[model samples]
Target: MTANAFMSISLDPPLIAISIAEKARMLGKIQASGRFAVSVLASGKDKIAWHFAGKPNPELHGLFDSLDGLPVVRGALATFSAEVRDEILAGDHTIFVGHVRALNWDSNADPLLFFKGKFGALEDTRKAPAGMLQIETELMW
Candidate 1:
């Protein structure tokens, strides 16, 4: 549940792929419902990320919100509802190719970033406009 193997596979017709573990409960739900949602958290929602990643932090309690019955991170930068288009087996995960059905975003919001086995926030650099902010401290284990 904490895994994030998702990627944008295409722009034409708005397609995305989420790699879910074969044993992930969410995978079963997606397959059963034929739909899924992606919520891209904004800076300050690291707890939300950790929460969904299967390690709920008590300090982040009550951080979850919803959109049309889909669990969404409160104050996320973006949320997308999609219909499952295809499923492909990949090693120990199943790649769920989704056709984005609806999407919403806040261009002004900085995104929560994950990389290199750590949770971090985007660092505003000369290449990007100023004012990127951190929600939670960079954490690695």
Candidate 2:
């Protein structure tokens, strides 16, 4: 459940997007409050992710705190405080786009990665294997 929430907006005009289920309780809070902070989970925080994912936790209420007056989870690899700028209805998900106002990151913290329904960490010291190739095709061409 500890997935990389790549919550970011363009800097030119400044925008952010956070996708949430329409039935989620947090969605109401976010919409009513008009503000929310994205806390990027750090490595070793898989338990926290699972807890937030609603897997069941008895003692995990109010685990996050307010950052710059915005709600944020602590011990994140990084955190971004944003204000709601726009909301777009996308089928069963609502994309909450915001304007980033503040940001911070832990120097020694490693990012938690989520892929194919599993949690993992990025190896900071490992370099991309040599001889990588990518190809893009344009239909116009």
Best by TM-score: 1
Worst 10 residues of 2 by lDDT: 1-10
**CA error at residue 93 for candidate 2, angstroms:** 0.6
In angstroms, the error of model 2 at 29 is 1.1
**Model 2 misplaced stretches (Cα beyond 4 Å):** 1-5, 59-62, 124-141
- Point out the worst 10-residue segment of candidate 1 by lDDT: 126-135
Error of 2 at 123 (Å): 2.4
Over all chains combined, what TM-score does candidate 1 have?
0.80
Q: Model 2 Cα displacement at 60 (Å)? A: 5.0
Candidate 2 lDDT score relative to the true structure: 0.78
Candidate 1 structure quality by residue, lDDT tens digits, 1-141: 555676888899899988998888888999999998888888877777787788877776556677656776667798888889999999998999999888889999988888887778877565534677646787899
The candidate scoring highest on lDDT is 1
